[model samples]
Target: MIKNLVHHKDNIVTISETMNCLDAIEILEQHSLRNAPVVDATNTLYRGNIYRYHIYKYKFHHPDADLAQVKVTQFLKNTTRVVHENDSFYQLIFAIRDLPFIAVLDKENVFTGVIQHDVMINYLAQAWVADKSGYVLAIQTRGEKGELNKLARLVNRKADIQSAVTFEKTTYDTSTYLMVTLPEYLDVSSVRALVNDLTRRKYDVNVVTL
Candidate 1:
């Protein structure tokens, strides 16, 4: 699963531990990169992660210090952040949250590549099927057993489902929020009929328009 999301080793931009901050910064700037994986001399083992901002921050403090003498290791940020290839998608999301990227490794701890920040955004868009023209419904209902199945039963009678997701309104609250997308060709009459059915069953539903 994660193998599909990873940018393989050959596609990665990496920095060696022996490289000075000056050379590392040059590589980062050339690619307009903010983060890169740091590796050992052989480029096999993962050392840690470095960010362009940390180097700039260091320079601001040690104005007279020569960056060429400074190793990239001095600025490593996500040193302990890494994911094994078999890790769950849930683990990947939590580990990758808000970072430029996170390292991916194999069973033997060999560096594979990374899961980039932009890739996660695209995954979310795909989950919502954002590129397709469709009817979307924003629904709110009490958190209870079989809520989704009941809604599905109603919607199936009217149109085929394109995508669906459920989330709690708040951690401490009992309310549930759901988003469901339907086929684009389904007529408005069918859509309205589905909504009416849901409402008659006491579900709070809204037709979401983009």
Candidate 2:
């Protein structure tokens, strides 16, 4: 699923290593960005990133220093983490969690655009669970054989599923949860019946959406 979420290089804004700190700062301000990837003169190679705070710090400590003469690369940080374009959505989610933005690389390992933190949040907000026209059902079942099929059959009897995501919910490995999203057109009575049926079948069911 994540293989399709990558942004291409042409869409990313980057600075060149040859650009001075003043020009780099101007570019950042123009885009209303806190940091941007730095590249070579050809703008194809990934150097590192430069931060706005670092630029100001450099200038503040050296008030008489020529800002235009100082190269942007001097303040570059090597801690930038990049993700591959073909990486799964799950991988991208983990990559961007603690990062302001993550660099994306094409198959050739060329620097592409960045996946900002906000972009991921927006993506999640639009996920099936967040769909207003649907109900997100957090259905808990055991890891035993045919549990998923049983759950599916019960849900299928009442509503059309929009999306389904399953994950282990318990630490001791006693139960698993499936985040199943049912289409919005399904009436409350049908959902209530579905939950009743699931509970009758011994499934721990919870309506996660209002």
Report lDDT per candidate.
0.86, 0.80
- Residue lDDT tens for model 1, 1-210: 777889987888999999999999999999999879999888778989989999999999999999999999898778879998999888998999878889999999998899998897898778777777468887786767887888787788998878898877666865677888887777888889999988888888889654
Most accurate candidate by TM-score: 1
- How many pairs in model 1 have backbone atoms within 3 A of each other, for residues 3 or more apart or on separate chains, i.e. clashes? 0
**What are the per-residue Cα lDDT tens digits for candidate 2 across 100-183?**
777877788777677777778878777755656458888886788987887788789888777788988657765678878887
Query: What TM-score goes with each of the models?
Result: 0.92, 0.81
Task: Summing lDDT over every window of 10 consecutive residues in candidate 1, give the lowest-scoring window.
Answer: 167-176
Residue-level error in angstroms, candidate 1, position 105: 0.7
Off by over 4 Å in 2: 1-6, 57-66, 78-80, 121-132, 170-175
Q: Tell me, by lDDT, which candidate is best.
A: 1
